[model samples]
Target: MEPLVVAMLLLLLARGHSALGLGGRNMWLIKEKVLQAREQRARDHVRGGQRWSSAALGSAQHLEPQEEFFPQPLDHFNRQNNATYKQRYWVNTKLWEPQGGPVFLYIGGEGALTTYSVLAGEHVDLARKYRALLVAVEHRYYGASINPDGLNHRNLHFLSSQQALADLAMMHAFISHRYNLSKLNKWICFGGSYPGSLSAWFRLKFPHLVHAAVASSAPVRAQLDFTAYNKVVSRSLSNPVVGGSPECRATVGAAFGAVDEMLARGESAALERDFRSCRPLDGSGDYGQLAGNLADVVMGIVQYNHELGIDATIAHLCRLMANTRLGAPYRRLVALNANYMERMSLNCTDNSYQRALEELRSEVVKPYGVGERQWYYQTCAEFGYYQTCEDEGCPLSRWLTLRSEVDVCAQVFGISASSVQGAVDFTNDYYGADRPKASRIIFVNGDIDPWHALSVLRNQSRSELALVINGTAHCANMNPPETGDPLSLQHARQIIEEQIGDWLSRRPLYPL
Candidate 1:
């Protein structure tokens, strides 16, 4: 009886062991199936993105082509810093070739990918003809390129112009190596507005690697005078045909003066005319045509053309206030005026406004600094970004406190700011050390653009710069001038295409 009981126990133990092993195998199989499914889904998405070219995020599995935006999910290999902090980037490329034509590395400005991609799309044909790969990368803390817990003031201290230049250089090297492409080919760096500043720096820093660079509306001078630019804004408005009326000019001047008075007095009544004559631009909730005019005023002041800027700006206001309907002409004018103003406003508000606000505080408590004293201290304390005031504005008023300690002339413009200052610092920086070798650079501008001071910078740049069109708006390459304009805009397009094609065919023997 004892032997029989022992045999039964041994049999039961063996069966239990076998069942446990089988269960473990089944679990492993399930996990493998799930992973496979995810990979397949990812591939399908990638395939869809083939229709529209995509910027890459690295992936373990091979990506496929498709006709949708973000068709597939790319994987990232996170590398942590000493603090266990990780930075994220998308490094996968679908259309990279080893010995392709010249690579056009297009850096983006302050805006998101939507704006960048649109610009890229417009120049797609030329890009393909050059056998060039167009890369549109997002800056840190902007768009999909995010740094988790990286946007606060403390961390943002790292996101300076110097760091941004480093980021561009690193990305360029990484892409060239990863795709097995020859870095020796012509590398053209180009961008407008904020990114234009980056382009200028990139050319200066990596002169050997970059064959050519085109920077438009780039503000390299750290200490820009915002109040001074009102001259340009006023000039744009004084066009004889549109804004040149005597009554229009008087109204604009009076309105601006009132705002100045209000700023000095800190009274809400100073905004009475601006509020009364202004009504919301159709579709814009509370914003009015007056806001658009104010933008023109600000722009005119920047380029030393205040009379035209103010005249055009006020005339535009009159036009808008007269027509509550928000018709086609009004819309077009508003768009053109507002577009230039938008960029101008943002730069002043972010870089200049904060400085002015700080200056105002210091004025009452202490002596004034280098900036305009009257404009430095404002009576109002509650103004915020995107919130336009009817009273006077202190564009450079905010930039009064924090003096940019960086040597703008020596370190930036290839000159010493200790001796010279203002736009000259920026002009010398762009033209002196960062000169482009290749003759394919193109400068596109609108005649009436408030930021036309950019033209002065272009003129200062080394030779081989071509102004494609004379527009009364911003970025009019895609939007050509009407039939009679003297500028050969169509010819400009042909020249651009031919030059790009030639460069791609035979890479320039640029200095490296």
Candidate 2:
């Protein structure tokens, strides 16, 4: 038991917040002259619609964007026994507008830098219209960055949040030093969702390196109420507007319930076969019916509100589900059912505590409402992450008791809870609320986010804590139009950009 506990401890310690350890806790004051220079640069960039003034553009102007491919190794899941292979990554800088202003280091989430760069260009003033040169980079796990082979779970721990933080800090430093802007430049980091958490963590670990951060829809809390999000999905599915007849919800609920029973009995054979046998979502399952099935499930989770007509939604899924009739009611219903199925699968695989929590919800709280099955509960039991209630029937009261010992291996930071907590604690102590540091960290969460409303659970410095309820969304509002901006919810992109712009300008934040 001691050894097991020790191993767990070591694993946790080796986890995320690598940037904090690497960046160190140093209180560096910006020189008065540097402050004046940065202020001037900010004004100039905002006025000139560029990141910096013409005077700020130095030798970088003559130096074209360096387009070079750098091959790196990737070893996330593979253990260290086989031969190591190499993957490729490209590093380059464009002629950014914020030449003399603060540098915006945008590290993209889970895709090629180009993919994220497009999103950034749309939401942000890429011409350095308001701030500094935007330096975007790719995530290590995705794209060209890769680890070595034969690296098992233990070794891959290096790929945790700590390493990511260190990587971003290093990138910032590299650009600062290379561009000779280290003395003249200030750093502002921003990202959404996975990258949003990364942005928040970056400021926490590298306060000295960064001035402020804008984290949108960041999932900082490890244990969140994902089951609640699922409830939203069910509610939406049952709504009549989307063609969900009264029976639609019950039938779908029954199907999921069947799945739940199978999981409780430790039977995944049926699901595995169902997944394989499910028809294609489109008219045919050329890519395989399973592909369409997976899409329907995931789309429901993302809840992407497309202007595409209901017929299009129905037609697309029907094709994926291999249903020929574009107007078939059964196909439409099945498509919505696929949404619940896909989301449950994701919650089970991506979240560590999702499965056990769902089981508990079903046993305890579910009786009062609907005794429906969720994907997370079934997946958890099937994957051996947790067990179901037995003998005493529904042990709802004891459901919470099971969580204390449950070990969740799935984490975005690639670290354990304790180590991540330690990293956060270090940040709080060093650059906490009372600290008179020039930099201020702002954390934003959509009220609907599972991780929302967790300030009560954690000890947050109230002065340092800033929560923005974006009309019940999942992430932070980047560019908000005053407090009561009346743009459609789908137009969150504009709101996000405006808000971040305000932060960079050091303008007063309005409304609540």
Candidate 3:
């Protein structure tokens, strides 16, 4: 579905505002939604006299056996302290010609590397075209690349972007020696989202290693209070060109206004009962948590919007919103939440704010740190992309202040607001924000992505290109090519392909 239409539906239903505040519940809802969508799609296929099976859904791409590890320094900056850890990585040489072809290296970010396919369809296609080797390296302190001691506050000091990039550089050298692929002189770094930012940074900091980079939906800038995120969400919802209905927009706005009035009048109890919150709404902290949780539902759907995939799109969500049986704004929101729950296949049972916070705290030490705690640690210590409703025209309630998000950082990691602010400032200064000291990097972002505002939207150098796709969402170009893909996405992919080809045809000019 078009981003604008989905935005309109979310706005009208106030699904992007606040609903259930439970993390587990949200996940459960998403999982259930995806499963239901798959089932329905399968039924549609059966009606059309086509065979439908789970294998069909899983046939998009496959990864090779990824049981490789590289020895990495615990601290890249302090070489004397020789504490080392194993960093995981994957390599696919099926398409590699070995006659001096470029290497396509995917930089993993914040999650388990095992989940990443050694070859995404599009990346595989690119490798075939360039006769390039496909490689994916896990970031330090993520996935199986855990610190030998543990992921305590003290151990996490080595998990910064600088160390991660150094790890990648070392991996490049290790792979070259291990595989005897030194003839493949050119390297092109590829990644999506946070890894995208890392890919661009790798090119910038270690140009000798990476000849070019493809940063899909990368947010290079560091902002403590990223209010622009919600503003883009608002714009995407109301854009007339994309078929966003003004009526829906106005209705959502009015509903939020009513919510603000209720909050002002101390109707927290009434809200709790109406919204079916698992816990009582006693204070601003609770309210902010609720708002953030609700906002996450909308943001997640919008971010992962795809054309031919079962992933929830704005169109699917809008249809669900229109057909919901519930009455009253609060009831309508609850129903809409159920719609997302069905669409995303999330199997959450409890929808309480307290329970969600507890789950976050408990999952800090889990493998790959899949919980919010690990990502929050990066935000507090490195890039502060805190999605706050501190700006005007935000869809969420004003009561949901930026301080609440900062408080989470402190509560989770024992870090202070001042320290987070300092870290953000340092990151900006170190990376050069949108105007990084880099070249031969292609920065791609969907116009509808909330994080697009924080990304480099304009070419800062001759070789650095920023391409934006219309009516698309985060990392659309990175996904497998679909027949229903928008012209903009297709065009962006073509440009990326051309850039990679051109970069490979040329020799590196060192000592820039």
Candidate 4:
């Protein structure tokens, strides 16, 4: 296989918090922000014109239960240990043909599998098309697929990608045996973002288990300082393809630079007052955290711009920034902060600056949730794809630095920079780094997605293909097709279907 393709397969299984989609742990933050924005807009419209009540924002949709549990070994590589834990899985065989059909396995990522709804729509459509059985397996330690031991540093040792892949292989065997479907040999894997990486890795590691795979927005390469993430965000905000405004981009750039200058001049009190921070900025750590949060807000908007509606678009953000009525850069900054607060339903008396600092602290300790802790552990152990502002050219450099990121990691995981480096090196060496040997996998990524830069964009073999969709957001092709979708996305979906169909039709040399 080509170097990029191999790297793609290796990197695909690892999750990055910088990107959007169901695969990352930060998706809850994105979902809440978008939902709150929509709700606030609806309320504003009602107050302005007529009396009306909108449906509850961010309400959960009722999904029929297809869940089950299987006992998975704690250490797949060590049979002597003989410890097992329950692994959660769901099956939707409603679209399957009676005799024998292809099984479509949807791999889970960093977050709880229950929060995963992307599989219910587009994957369901794909399953119906192929008359395949749809199976969704929750990653070990995520959701209810908890390890018998608590999720401290000790237990997380078992939560590696290799172990997760082993879990999938065992789950497949159990499912086949339980359903009496051993004769149904064809199995296809589908996932987006981190799970997208998993789907690709599944085929690469166990070709005999999975005949084909669709890995959407799967970043295959791991880097210590992921400066490309911010670079891509900057490009997305200025690119005409995404309807970005030059004036808006200029205003944002200036605002970031201005903030940096102010902080450098010891204007923390003024910043606290202007930005409405809950607490005073004590040191560079607090300032850096605030800056990172602001950058995350911008990235989150661009990552899910399609779902946030026109008001949340790059053009819209630019319009807000460039408005003469907004007065100085500080005022524009406040306006931007206010917009994000309202959208995220962050109803604290503390300003955005304060909240940003608090959020950073929370992410480090991750006391608020398991997903953050679990995902961060993976990063510390296997991949150090820390989304840092290493690129000086990027606007985000005003507030973040590589030092701050490394410090956060040290504080959170009790590991030094050298330890992280060692772990990253080990991961790269184990997973083949840039020379992965994999086949029969379709890698898909959107041009605008920050993670796309890390994925395979070239054909490595006849069976390994890369599909890049233009004028699309993260994992756009994996979602249900919309009337407003770009032609490239539509074409990508068609090609994926064709490739899968071809894979399913081929006879397997080895019997199940």
What RMSD does each model have against the real structure? 24.3, 15.9, 7.5, 9.5
Cα lDDT tens digits for candidate 4, 1-512: 22442243233224331111111122447754543443354334333422211331112232234467899998999999888888878876555775778888888877656423323445666776878877888888776787545376566688888899999999989878877776565788988777888888888888878878998988767677778887887888787877776666667777776766665566778777665666776555455545655666667767776767666666677778778798976578678877876765665223233343234334232212236567766777777777765455575534455545555566656778788788888866765553456889888988878888777788888888888888777777766555678788888888888888898888758865
Report lDDT (Cα) of residue 236, candidate 4. Answer: 83
lDDT of 2 by residue, 222-291 (tens): 3322233334434444444433343444444443334333333334344444443322222111111222
- Note the Cα lDDT for every prediction shown: 0.38, 0.39, 0.67, 0.67
- lDDT at residue 304 of model 1 (Cα atoms): 26
How far does residue 458 in candidate 4 sit from its true spot (Å)? Answer: 1.3
RMSD of candidate 4 to the truth, in angstroms, is 9.5
Q: In candidate 1, what are the lDDT values of residues 1-512, reduced to their tens digit? A: 12442353244345531100000011112223322333343344334453344343235244322211211111112234323222223322334344655666666543333322322332434454455565655544344443454433244334444545666676777667756666555677666545665666676667766766655545433332223233344454455543444343344454444333333232423232323322222211111123323443333332322222333343455454234364433243333344433533332211122232233223231111111211111001000001122223322111111112112122222323333343334444544422333344555454555444433335443434545344344333432123443355466556656655654566446843
Model 4 regions more than 4 Å off: 1-28, 31-63, 115-119, 349-370, 433-435, 508-512
Candidate achieving higher TM-score, 2 or 4: 4
lDDT of 1 at 398: 17
What is the C-alpha local distance difference test score of candidate 4? 0.67
- Candidate 1's displacement at residue 270, Å, is 7.3
Q: Sorted by TM-score, highest first, which candidate order results?
A: 4, 3, 1, 2
